[model samples]
Target: MGMLGNTFDIEQIEVHKGPQSSVFGSNAIAGLISLRSKPITDNFQSGFSISLGDDSHKAVKGFQNIKISNFLKVRYIIDYNYRDGFRNNILNGMIDSNRKKELFSRLKVEFHPIDQVRILGTYINANLDNRYDVWSPDNNEQFETYTDSLGEDSQKTQGFSLRSKMKINEDFNLLFISTRSNTQLVHAYDGDWANDSYWLDEHQFDPDSTGYNYSFYEKNKRSRHNDSQELRLSFKNLVTGFYFNNLSEKDDAIGYLFGGLGDQADGRYDFKAYAGYFQIHHNVAKKLKVMFNYRLEKNMYKYVGNTYDNYYGDDLPLVNYESENTMMGYKGSLLYALSDNSNSYFSYAKGFKAGGVNQEPNLNEFERIFDPEFLTNIEIGIKTIMNNFGYVINAFFGNRNNQQVTISKQRNVGDPNSFYFYTANSTSGYIRGLEMDLNYILGSNFTFQSTFGILDTYVENFEYELIENVKTRAGDRETAMAPKYTASFGLKFEKMDYYFLTSASYKSKYYYSDSHNKRSSAYTLTNITIGKKIKDFNLNFWVRNIFDVKYTIRGFYFGLIPEEDYPNQLFESYGNPRHFGITLDYGL
Candidate 1:
């Protein structure tokens, strides 16, 4: 990802490191990112910012805050970004095969009707349009693609949320939040990545469609909607977790834009869920505290689909399948105050990932669903602060069952030349890691911080069928995307009205597929920023990937040509290169 520098409207960012499903449910398996929005001030405020960079990249953002009355206030934010890409399409010789464009806006309102009551409302809208060209041969440059067709990736999201806070009593308070959100994604690409002329001249094949160059064009769509409500009760030294429901339904389709052979495919995943959670925290002794939490949930899933092929006719019977599960999760912890500026804690947690319908139904027995997943985790940590310096150290271990793993062979349904991504359940796995964070300050003029992480993930038992004749031994193998080593270092400087910041991060190599046969090499990146602030106005210059290093974001094993001619090959989607940009912000 590229950096756009900091604007005037940002506050502190919070990062969580462990499994967050105990509080956030199933989606926080790895971790979670939380941004603390700036508070609405009592006075009127407005801000504007713009950024310009290499490769014709540009960004414009603005925010407005209005104090309508003593009891009401409103704020809104809008941002737009565009980039003319750096990669070239080797087949068509056109640049911007990897361009990006995005638009986002948010509105927030705060209302205070009574002395002890407060209400907040927020609405967010976002749209994204981008080009993706990643296919290439091994001998090509890093910034080139071999596809002869055009592709587009587009997405949009809309959200609305309401929150209420009330001081119920002196010793207890209540907080409630309700949200509704939806997201839609559309992906269209060339199925074969080769023009008809190439196929006709080299392989002596002709199709019915003659107006276009592509042999096959495919478009896919996915959409999701969610409605949730949460209520929290806070006491003097305790917090509460209440109830959850995930009545989820999926409507997805894949159809051809051209051609008749690879015509259409449709799929669906419908599910319902309900959960209840409870927690308690209390001081057991003078310097020690004990906490306990528990949760239980019920999940029901149904699968429905209609898949077709020209040769095989229909892949499935176009019927409905159902599965259901009930699971429990718990957490217990002990915390002790070692000193006035130091503390230590030990925690144990259990998490769950409910089962879901399958995307690919080509199995022998026609099993149409994967089982739910569960995890057991334990951790011990210490935190200390001494005037100008602070540090946190932690060690963790986790055991997992029915783990979900997605392996992409890049074969699209109905079309012989596209890609279909599917998820399946793995038997068992374990994860162990160590992490440390350090922060130091030098007389309010300089600040330094660093984080280091070491992780090891392995599957204990499972076997995955790669093809009709080949199956990968998935036992005792390292998991995908689990880099063994990762670290980041950052420094911040401030003097009189000027500020400067620099950061360096590193990640070790990791595998991209379930077979563990292919991997990405280790890489490091550096970024720097120098900015000046004049009261309500600010300006900055920044650069990312200063060393111009090459890295991979995604990789796949697939064949682009006819099955009889070319075998499956390794392909990669590369990371961004060196980028430099300047930003200006004004506040009034």
Candidate 2:
């Protein structure tokens, strides 16, 4: 649900895997991504693109479409990008400490007064500014950083949407949708990534030890709002829907801003949802088909929290919470039609997730409410085409109940950056998976592709306690970044307007946290592309990580070095090293 503009103004992209929550509801239970954008016809079009790279990368993108006659149509899109951050902040010599910037704009409209009605509208504007001085005390210096407060990640977003389609005469059909969004966020960091003469050489024998003079800063300001509405109806084989949602959030947090001894917090959250859905398909003969789906949801939540702790000078009280829940989801399927190309299927699903409230800031009462998690899935699939080759395969099994696990807490236990994070509820879990896709065509200009996956995740018990009566158990771990074999392969070559491509990807070995047992060590990446098309003008060249492989996407296992007095290390973040780019395009 976080998608805005430009994939060349997408026309379609659909990916659904496991648990669609009986037709898109509640986080989709880890599956679902659907987007469709390009529409607006009747001639008139335009396009543009430009890019250049190498640390100081820059880019520009565009699109346009118009036709305002018999029934109105319009479209426009824009994108901008900038980059200059390869990280080399030797303490403020400022090489744009991890820089990046982006802007996106979009607008679309279509209306056909009558002809059985149709209307569509959309508008969006976005901005994302990023810079977060890559944490380091040394992960073998991937690029480099010796921060003294230099970090930020920003966001600004605006959105709107409306849709409608009607044609109720020849056997029912109607649809409507509405959406709204707003987001503003800023995240700040630099919690002693080292500077200040390395804490005065680790306090050289107590040289005014204000705990080795640490300096940490944190800023978190966020605001979010969302609204949604949907209605649907269609004849023949049934389809029905109704949904409404509203969400609100606010947070303003500040922390440890150096000696003023700070730590302030404020929070508010609200959510509401209601749903009704139905789907059915039947034709159990001549190639077989059967399907059924159902959904019912109701959820409401609210929270308020406040805190202040100027180095423990008190004032940590004032909190309120509320919750309600009722959820149900279902699906069943069976399909077969193994001729005209091929097909096969079998499925079962049930998923739900709702129950939250952990705006962290000193919490107890089971770390401030957390519950509600469920998933059950079973699947089997197959698809095939034989002439030039095509294939797909899937196999899955899953089970989880009350699982949601994320835990962290540390406040001045010698200040390992005084961490805080929460989410807990783990009682059972299981997962199994297999997936594959392949394609090949060689007669008219060569192409080949492949994909692979296999996974297993487990965590059977978790009896928690961070510290307080000390109790712990995490029976058989292995559920943190869950990675066990993944692969990709590609090759392409075209003959008409020149083209070439190469790709590679792989991953294995993972575990960044189930709260400790750091691991990550399997990586591969390769990419290359070249293109040319001289009709409407197009040119391209690209290279990415073609041999520069220094992996680690994220890792953090505590300990902030006061000469190892804070031991438990393992801090990393590295990905993206080799890159090359060039692009130019023009169209009409």
Candidate 3:
């Protein structure tokens, strides 16, 4: 959802790095990106914002908040966005081949039953209509397209959450949270890049053997829902928490020619998980403090081929399993006051992640089983907040065992786009990294913030390459999708009722495939914004990718055409080009 970051309704975005299993869960292994919506105020508030940009991009946002009474309040938000693709169809001059449309709404209410109790309820609805049109092997330009059929990726989602806090005494409180969500997706694509006129001769030559239909199309789909609950109790020096979640998923990935044979691969998956945790903190001396946390977690999974509501089993019986696994997670930390403006912390944390079932059937006899993953982390960091400036620096060492890796299936001739993915585990790996974040308030109403991350990784004992069928030597390469370095810098200037901000971000080259030879090039992007506010009204202008650099974010190696049967070649998707926009805002 990075594209939605430009929306004016978002108040703040929080990034939590490293393994957070002691608090959040297994999904927060690498890191966590949290979006905090703009909070509702006590008095009445209303606002609207509009934006227009290049590529026919447009957006609208509006919100209202009211205090209904002394005991209750309500807030509502609505957002809409639309953008034309950067490239046009060479066939019909259609400019929106990669177009995207998004609509979202949210309702929130707060209740104060008494002096010691508080409750919040929220409901949300969202829809995304995205079109897919990317590159073909024959084309080298960023905006060129050669596919025959149009593709679509559409999703509809709805969810709700409830949170409550009860104050039991002067130094204790209880918290409860529950959430539910439902989602469905529709995705289809052109399996053959070229039109029938280009392949007519090859098809007619082998009609008796290949049949009459050769043109191809494919679709992969997902429908899933989940419910979860969490409870916590906090005291002066201790806290305890328990959480549970359940998820059910149904998937279909199928392909077919115009009139030829069709292949079907469908499955159902169910997951249930439970976790309990306890934490305690104490100050042993005037300038020293320590904390400890422990968590016990269990996860279960069941898979069948038939259906989500009707589980009768597939005829081929692709893969079936009912497995339960449990592990212990722990964390310990010590904090010392370095000076009146700075503090230092040392921490050690161990976390566990449950293994999951493979979505695709096994082509070879490797059992298609992945083991649970584990991580041990040790960190030493310092953080300080002074009147004019603040900075945080951290050095970390971590070991990840049984790291899960996803590999793309080897491509065949006729089904270039109908690819499936499966997962495996690395025996052990080592990762070391340094991170720094700095924010400074300048003398002339100017502010600056910058963050840098440098990482080094090695695969220790991995000896097998699944897709390429090769033996991997020690220290041969790093893990896939792990970048070596990333950095960002930003500057902000505000005086009176006006503000201007600009930022630049960079990421180093990284590997995507585990045959592990294919990699993406490093890239940098810049963005700037200017806005003014007057009597609850605001106007803004922004520009993104000011230099319009060409870069790729994802890549895969694949083969095409049954006639020549060539070796695999790299195919990639490019990032967006330069975009500039202006916005008018009220009470925002």
In order, candidate lDDTs are 0.75, 0.81, 0.78
Q: lDDT of model 2 at residue 294? A: 88
Q: How close is candidate 3 to the true structure, as a TM-score?
A: 0.90
Model 2 over residues 449-509: C-alpha lDDT tens digits? Answer: 9999998888776876766667777647778888988999999999899999999999997
Please write out the lDDT profile of model 3 over residues 202-246, one tens digit for every residue.
333254566754456777788889899999999999999999999
Task: Select the stronger candidate by TM-score from 1 and 3.
Answer: 3
In the predicted model 1, the residue pairs found to clash are 412-418
Question: Model 3, residue 295: displacement in angstroms?
Answer: 1.4
lDDT of the structure predicted as candidate 3: 0.78
Using all chains and alpha carbons, the TM-scores for the candidates as numbered come to: 0.89, 0.33, 0.90
lDDT: worst 10-residue window of model 1: 1-10
Instruction: Give the per-residue Cα lDDT of candidate 2 at 383.
Output: 91
Candidate 1 residue 278 C-alpha distance from true site, Å: 1.5
